[model samples]
Target: MLALPTLSSNGITLKPLTLSNATDLAEACQDGELWKINETSVPEPDKVMDYINTAASMPDRQAFVVIDDLTGKAIGSTSFHDILPFVKRLEIGYTWYAKSYWRTHVNTTCKLMLLTYIFETLEYQTVGWRTNIGNHRSQQAIERLGAKKDGVIRGNRVCRNGVISDTVMYSLIKSEWLPVKLELTKKLNDAH
Candidate 1:
């Protein structure tokens, strides 16, 4: 199992998600009742512990709670799952933030931090992302990060609502990281 490290930058922090974070995460989900969104993996307040446990139990996943440093509150969650150390690759998924944080610099900063750690620190070759086909906003966000759409998998998995959904795939190889990193840094700077 890979050890997850705490990452912080630009007033945001990504800490390893744990059972102790359950209360904060539950409150974060309540911001927009995120659990109601079928396409997302956000859990209901009552299920927060189960969610954290499941995430922690995954041998191939490293989950993090997105925290707003200014307030020391959990704002959302994201993970590096589907790890393939042999191939030096992983997919970033199971990400969601409070509605108020949307359209802000939070996502960009988080992506920059994760990308830097994966590509530079960890020396990973490629990073991938997968989202529900119906999640247009997520698709746009992933694209905005410079990930190229690879394709979609039909009936990839059943969603929380029991609907079988297509999964949209995207990836960014190491060769593409420099430009993407520059762009992400620019976006963060411009947001200030």
Candidate 2:
């Protein structure tokens, strides 16, 4: 199993996801608007803990709470999932954030930290992302991070809403990691 290190950088931190974060996480999910795009959307506030627990139970998943360092509050969740040990590949996904945090440096900073750990510390060959075909927002975000689109897998995934969707895949290979890391770092620094 890939170890998940607690990551902190540029006013954002990622710590192991626990049931204790349910309250804040639940609050973040209140908009329910984001539900449509989430791969595993919690239908109601009460389902948040169950969702967290289910994520916790996955052997291949290392879930984490995306914390806002300024407030010390849970603002979102992201993880390293769908890892292939022998193949030396993993995904940075199962990620969702509060409505208020969208379009902010939060995601950029978080990705910088996660990618740093995945490509630097773990020295993984590839970090991948899979989003619903209709999820243009997510696709754009991954692209902005310099992950190349590897095309879509038609009807390969089922969303929480029971919709069968095409999975649009993207990845950052080892050779691309360093340049992308520098670019992301510069972007994050420029934000301040």
Provide the TM-score for each candidate, comma-separated.
0.98, 0.94
Q: What is the Å distance of residue 188 in model 2 from its true position?
A: 0.9
lDDT scores of the candidates, listed in order: 0.94, 0.85
Give the alpha carbon lDDT tens digit for every residue of 43-115 in model 2: 3577888889898889999898999989888888998999997888999897888888888998898998888
Runs of candidate 1 exceeding 4 Å displacement = none
Report the Cα RMSD per candidate.
Answer: 0.6, 1.6
lDDT (Cα, 0-100) at 60 in candidate 2: 91
- Residue-level lDDT of model 1, residues 1-192, one tens digit each, is 668899999999998998888898999999989999999999999999999999989889989999999999999999999999999999999999988899999999999999999999999999999999999999999999999999999997899989898999999999999999999999999889
User: After aligning candidate 1 to the native by TM-score, how far in Å is the CA of 172 from where it should be?
Assistant: 0.4
Lowest lDDT block of 10, candidate 1: 1-10
TM-score of 1: 0.98
